[model samples]
Target: MKTIEKNVGKKNIVLLVLPQVQLLDIAGPCDVFTSATRFLANDQAGYNVFIVSGTSDKILYSSSGMSLPCSHTIYDIDFPIDTLLVGGTEPGVLHEINSDLYTYLRHIVKETRRIGSVCIGAFALAKAGLLKGKQVTTHWKYADLLQKSYPELEVNINPFFIKDQKIYTSGGVSSGIDLALALVEEDFGTFLASEIARHLVLHLKRPGLQSQYGNALPDYDMMSSFTKEIRDLLKDKLGQAISVEYMADSMHMSVRNFSRVFVRESGMTPGKFLEKMRLDQAKNLLEYTDMGIEMIAGKCGLGSVVSLRRLFLKHLSVSPAQYRKTFKRAD
Candidate 1:
């Protein structure tokens, strides 16, 4: 492998984009690096971002029907990449993994400081054998497929972004911005990153562990009739003190059988599903209503503020107050 010499002053951040790319996956991160330059003392301490086409073409069409002009092809990149991020394409493009692209990625991995993927871009990295045995994530919709495709990799769908060693993978579209902000924080400091985030009009520079607010509901069509019935019952009586035994009796089954069937149908234990429901309700109330923590807790059937805070901390790594402050919708 031929080594590319690192740039002396500004770190060169390269984004590798393929055809039918998601525009935000490229634009969001590029904006973060570009915006960071404004706050820096000089150009020497900033980032220089470049867009490289994964294919031979210099022009790539985005998933949104926007045409993107690439400055360089993958073969044209001879300079050292401080960070290399792969932007995702539409699902149809993901099926055809380019062998040449994979080879280029493998070669470049030796010269890059850190590598990352935005959304389904993890598929590219995985195809190149870059994510072997690494804990990573992608857009929630494709997390299951990615897991099945690469059994060696730990595909966690919950986090907005995750960094394992030098590789970073982010969830859906806007999560690329979060990943870039974190990268900026790592390269410079929290103060600079926070300033950039503020300039971007971001309410909060959410941590990597923060959950992605994707589709939270289980697949109703796939659930058994009994499971669907229990789901509806739980939804209607979320604020009531409902027990597993009660649910079991209502369904005319023993607790053990009910638990087993629920797990098989819902893909989570009955207790876990109930907790998730309560948490989802609590989150909605926190985001949309001007309610007190205790009131919100009671409304969500969490019973007390302590339980609510504990649940938030355990799942979101943020307190109820903090979550409210960050996500509260403008009235």
Candidate 2:
């Protein structure tokens, strides 16, 4: 692998394309990286990006109709590279990467300054022995498979991203932005990162180590129809005071029995669930809307800014004002 370095612009960024690459996984980060470099370049738009794949260096069409032209083939490029980024799929396009792809990966891992993968791309890196004994992450859907296939690699899907020595890996699709932001922050500073995020309209620069389970709740599909009804009712009545007993009556059950079953299915008591819902809403409002803290409190069912603050601080570990100040989308 050969690398190219300019005086101040982005070093070479190589994205390996494979069959069945998820459109968003590849495109989303490409957008962010290009956006970040443009902002950093100010007037130059300095990144020299290339999309390469296992096959010919033609237009690598994604699962979606969008096609990104490959600047060159992996075999042809032998420049000093800053980074090699791989995109992932639900199940990757290749069952096993050809010896050529694997060899190219090994060559770069030994030569490149930093190596990383997005989503199931981590699967390929592990397959090529690029992530051996490295702390890594991938989309949650593939966590089980990754662990089973590459026990030598330390896999952590909970984080937005993970870095082990020279190898970096991130969770599902959009998370690549988070990892890229972290990289920009490392290479430049908080100001550059914040500006890039502003142009990209990313609200928060959530740490790569931040738990993906920060507020994980059961999926809508996991809920029974009755639970869905209850969940819907809660959302609708979020601005009002609601009680478990009231919910029980509406659902045609005794309060004690209803509470018992709700907790069992939701993994949280009624009060806790309600609090989470309100706080989640409050968080969104704080991040994206200009509603006053007091107004947001009322709209999200916390009733008062004081209660909202307490809950946000308790669970999210940030004050509403501080959170808004930091995470408010810029552009």
Instruction: Compute the lDDT for candidate 2.
Output: 0.74
lDDT of 2 by residue, 1-331 (tens): 3222223655677877876777777677677668767665544434566777766556666777677677777778866788788888545465644667777788788888888988888877887888778888887656645776677877766678888877889887788888877776666666766777887788546643333233333446655676678889888788998999999998899999999988666655888878877876777787778989999999988878899889876765668898788777765
Please list all clashing residue pairs in model 2, or write none if there are none: 2-78, 2-79, 2-80, 3-79, 3-80, 3-81, 4-80
Report lDDT (CA) for all predictions. Answer: 0.83, 0.74
Poorly placed runs, candidate 2 (over 4 Å): 1-9, 42-46, 207-331
Residue 316 in model 2: lDDT: 56
Which window of 10 residues has the lowest lDDT sum in candidate 1?
1-10
Q: Candidate 1 at 28: error in angstroms? A: 2.4
Q: Measure candidate 2: CA RMSD.
A: 8.7
